[model samples]
Target: MHDLIPFIPGSVNDVLGSLPFFLPEIYLTALFILVLITNLLFGRNSEKLCRIIACAGILLVIQRDYQQIQLLFMSGRLNGQFLFNEMLLLNRTAINFKFIIDALAFVLLLYFGWDNRLKSHPKGLSDLYTIVIGSVLGLHLMAMAVNLLSIYLAIEMVSIASYLMVTYRSENAFGTEAGLKYVLFGAASSAMMLYGISLLYGFTGSLNLFSGNLLPGLIQANPVAVSFSLVLVLVGIGFKLSFVPIHFWVPDVYEGASTPVTAWLSTLPKIAGFALLINFLRPFVYFEKWDGFDFKLALSIIGIITMIAGNFAAIMQRNVKRMLAYSSIGHTGFALMAIVTYNSTGIAALTFYLAVYGLANIGALALATYFANALDADDMNSYKGLGLKYPAASVCFVIVLVSLTGLPISAGFTGKVLVFSSVYGIYQQNHNLWLLLLMITGALTTVVSLFYYIKIPLNLFLKRTEFVKNTLIKSQNIIVLSIIISVLIVLLGVWPDFLFKLF
Candidate 1:
């Protein structure tokens, strides 16, 4: 082999440049390798040790990255493009908000490890943590990727990891079926996205999304083809976000996967997917100025359809996971409203909304998982009399459900208000009557959403069913932590500025 000294200078500069921004992922990678090796060498007893290391690694990343984010913003590196030939961008906006994302991942990771449901299967626990860390690292990369190739790779990385997490318990038919469905659908979507990427590259002669200036010309030349390519790409994103017309696999996967994995699947990837959506749409924000391209109208139509379809379908669901899956689809539409505004305030609102929404969803899923394990049922009917049997847990569930419904004095309400006001501002400036119609539709959907959301409390508190032994098993630390998150949800709703200030 050639002497290493010849490449030392260039390699050193690359390493140094990528070091600070990649610290969190690097830490995770190291911990993941350690966990794998320890499991192989030290046997099953070392599973808990791996969990501790994973949790510590994630927390350390969050703390270090949070400080790094502040420093980067203070130093005016918010928009700085670092190593890898500018494929990776370290922006203040992404950096500040991604710290919160990392923290959210830490909370979910802690819950995944500490939940008693997974404690008996040590090897599975280790494998699950490894997959989670891998997916989280992919998400971190996705938020910063500036090229089409990096974007596709980041998405596929997360997708493959998620498929494994869904199929971890492969002995069961549900796990096997969910895994098969996910891989088949995911592979097809990825292939379509790749073809779209190839078309864009062939038309533009560049793969760097930020620097590529061919979209306007291509759209003018062939509006239909460009729109086709855009839709094809959105198929991949829509799968992750679980939007209408591309959400057929979500309920199956959610119902089949274990509750903890389902919780992670529902929240973290969706947040990252939305962030990617906002980033991709930045160039198309001035669609009116571009010849023959009406991206805003297209997005508005999709948002409207997603909202109506998601809300109407959710009304018929009795399975808790299935209902939440539909509810997530509706929230996807709500989040897309912020994207339609296409301004700094809209981005900020979407970021804050996603943070709170993810926290609440994860907390709710944790409680749901606990109840499912305790009662040995995942149906809504099993929740009957839970209000009296498990008052604290049931109350926490109510708070989370209320937040999901966007009721007053909850983060969900603040998120909805922010999205509505931003869209309203856009409407006032442009006199777009369609926005007002959508706003009204969104309001009506929220009311409809409340009916389904309240079903949990109704069954638990109001309707009495066959009485079972009301044994009070001490709450897991994870459950208590989830409740604390619910408290933050309400606090952020009451004082919306608390999070906005960080960005």
Candidate 2:
């Protein structure tokens, strides 16, 4: 009975002492409040102002954290230690992840504000910007969460904001429906995770995973029951990460939502999900330290299944947005493969892939909206001969697609190579059959992914059709942003060592 109670102990002083390391979050919280106030004071008219504020805040945080990350790299020291009585951590990893989230937010807001469709919405985009700022705040915390309660809260924050963003335009039935589906799925996952957390607290007698009694208690718990509960906790994570078996929500949600929303969904949440998952598992994977079940093996199995399922499913998609949705699911699996390596190399690889993935996916979805507006069609069939008429866009789209397919001369290729190297190193060390299986699955899926990704280029070039008037993505900023992102993707591919050395 004593073990059934959660032990959560911390003092006010502890939280106070941790404030210095929590500056990134504090900055976000302040900005969230400022955005809210700005929205209220200016209402719909504040849309541009709010966007500027949101982007500026995110950029500032990015600068601060990036500098900190650089300092940590140069010093070759980890600044993250347990903070707030070990409920949160402040380390180089968390900082870098925060930087990624903030940087993506900054870029995304620029796209969102520049998108004429959203800019023309009657209610305006002010509220949405506030919501996004809040969401990033949650994700920032999610990356740093080391306690069960904090993790739960962080997931809820992101989920709630995502639901709102999906349903922002009540005029769009597809988006509203997607929002409803997301809510139902999100709630169920959260409930299941809560139950799992309760079970963990019961077994370990502590809310903190690394607490004195938690690990030993976990080891002594019934292996079967503990494994089941642990997986239950991961249900929420898998949902966010969009891994297979828990990825049913992705495609429809991606197709139904607007491009900017889809880009944010596919990138930030997934990165934070994997970061949290890896952080939570660190104690177990690194040590023969605490083991009642083989979590690493379980993760490996999921990774393989996700890669095979996501890539194969993408082959069946004709709608470009939905195809990329499934493609994002495949990337989720590839990320898991990196996470499974359970070391610094794995972390570096994961970080690099996520950075490139964010850039390419954002650029791809942006191009999707551009094409949809230009051709007035969402399917591959509509894209025929578009390459001839819009050579620049078609070429850039090809670049994005090439990167997504893990082709050479793109960041996706470099990301794949890094992951393969990590997985191979693990196999060499352990000769683990499971590791071997994941590696093979990852490689084979990369080849299979080529078929679907090729459809875009094929449609643009091979199939011939006349171009329609496209008013959707006429914004010069959007076009320029897409090209710049594509350029960065190729740069990262060619100079992978540039970022790798920083890590």
Q: What is the C-alpha lDDT profile of model 1 across 1-503, one tens digit per residue?
A: 47878888887888787776677678868877877786677677666777787788888878777776766767677656554755667666667556766788778877776555555553657767777778888887777776778878989999999988888765368767987998899999999988988877777677776665655556545677777777888888878888878888888888788778888889888988877776667656644455554656766777888888888888889999889888988888888888878887778888888888888898888888777657755778888887887888888899999889999899999988888988888889987876876788789999999988989999999988877545434447756886798889889988889887775
lDDT of 2: 0.84
Instruction: Report lDDT (CA) for all predictions.
Output: 0.79, 0.84
Q: What is the C-alpha RMSD of each candidate to the true structure, in Å?
A: 3.1, 3.0
Q: List clashing residue pairs in candidate 1.
A: 78-91, 78-92
Model 2 spans with C-alpha error above 4 angstroms: 1-10, 70-79, 466-473
The sequence of per-residue lDDT tens digits that candidate 2 reaches over residues 1-503 is: 67644442346667776776667778889999999999999888898899888988888888777666655556555656677888877677787788778888888998886655556678899999989999998998889888888888889999999998877764377767887888899999999999999998899888786566767788888888888888998998888998878989899888887778888999999889977887788777765666567877888899999999999999999998899999999899888888888888888999988988988999988887677656556888888878877777788899988888889989999988998998888889989998999999999999999999999899889987654555544556767888898888888889888777766
TM-score, cand. 2 vs. native: 0.95
